[model samples]
Target: MKRVYLLVITLFLLSLNMSAQKVYSVEYANQANVKVFVVDYENQADLKVFKVKYQNQAVKNEGRWFFTDYANQADKKIFFVKYANQADLKIYFVKYANQAGWINQSKLHLMY
Candidate 1:
């Protein structure tokens, strides 16, 4: 019974950590898990992103991102690409947190 309880608690904590949208911007494209492109228009984006001030506010994969100072502290490491064709994901910055979400569901796995 004690083992079962410990296992459940461990899984719950891991799920919470995995769901947080903590990101780090890498200087080199080779070091990034995903290459991102900033779109000129929101309609042209795969995801609409909102920058959150706190890491706790950036929960789940709803496009709310907390930029981490170090790559080791981040859930995902990304590199900004010069062109959309070179990107794994295309994003646009939204003014409000509520406006942040995936526009293209097909590209959702790229964030994970």
Candidate 2:
């Protein structure tokens, strides 16, 4: 039916929007919505993050953080914490940077 086709198209578009994930770092922790810590080991991290070069290459709320030069230009602003315990989200940096996604998808909503 035409309605079914329209629904499918709408869902596809929504999925496309949700798939755009990009992150920016704020100067101050107080200025950031999410306070994060970079773990030295992958197992120590709550989430594994990959840095994306382009903003458009990022996902909606995945771990693909794009550090904006300016705080005002950021989407989901974040701050780096010295201690893992002090962080709201603990992440590990991966060598391969592609498809800015999350290793642990549970914390995905925290970015939003």
Candidate 3:
């Protein structure tokens, strides 16, 4: 019973960590975990992103992102590419938080 409680607590903590979408923008593509391209239209995007002011508000892989001041503080480091073909993920910035989400489920792993 004690082991089961510990396992539950551990899983809960890991879920919180995984949901925090803290990101850093890298200067070069080689320094990044994912290469991203900004789409002019929302329909052309793989993910619809919403920039959140607070780190706590950036929860979930649902496209809510918090930009960290330091690279070490981020969960994922990304570099913006000029062309769509050079990108691992294409994103569109959304005006509202509710509009943020993944359009292409196959490209979802790139954020993780």
TM-scores of all candidate predictions against the true structure:
0.87, 0.72, 0.86
Task: Please give the distance, in angstroms, between residue 9's alpha carbon in candidate 1 and its true position after superposition.
Answer: 10
What is the clash count of model 1? Answer: 0
CA error at residue 27 for candidate 3, angstroms: 0.4
CA deviation > 4 Å runs, candidate 3: 1-17
Q: Encode model 3's per-residue lDDT on 1-112: one tens digit a residue.
A: 9999999999999876685489999999999999999999999999999999999998779999999999999999999999999999999999999999999999887877
> What is the TM-score (0 to 1) of candidate 1?
0.87
Q: Give the TM-score of candidate 3.
A: 0.86
Model 1 C-alpha lDDT per residue in residues 1-112, reported as the tens digit of each score = 9999999999998876566489999999999999999999999999999999998998878999999999999989999999999999999999999999999999888776
Candidate 1: segments with Cα more than 4 A from true spot? 1-17
Which candidate should be chosen as best, given TM-score against the real structure? 1
Location of the lowest summed lDDT over 10 successive residues in candidate 1: 12-21
Error of 1 at 41 (Å): 0.5
Tens digits of lDDT, candidate 2, 1-112: 9999999999998875673245667778888788999888887776777887887766556566677777666766778989888898888888776533566767767776
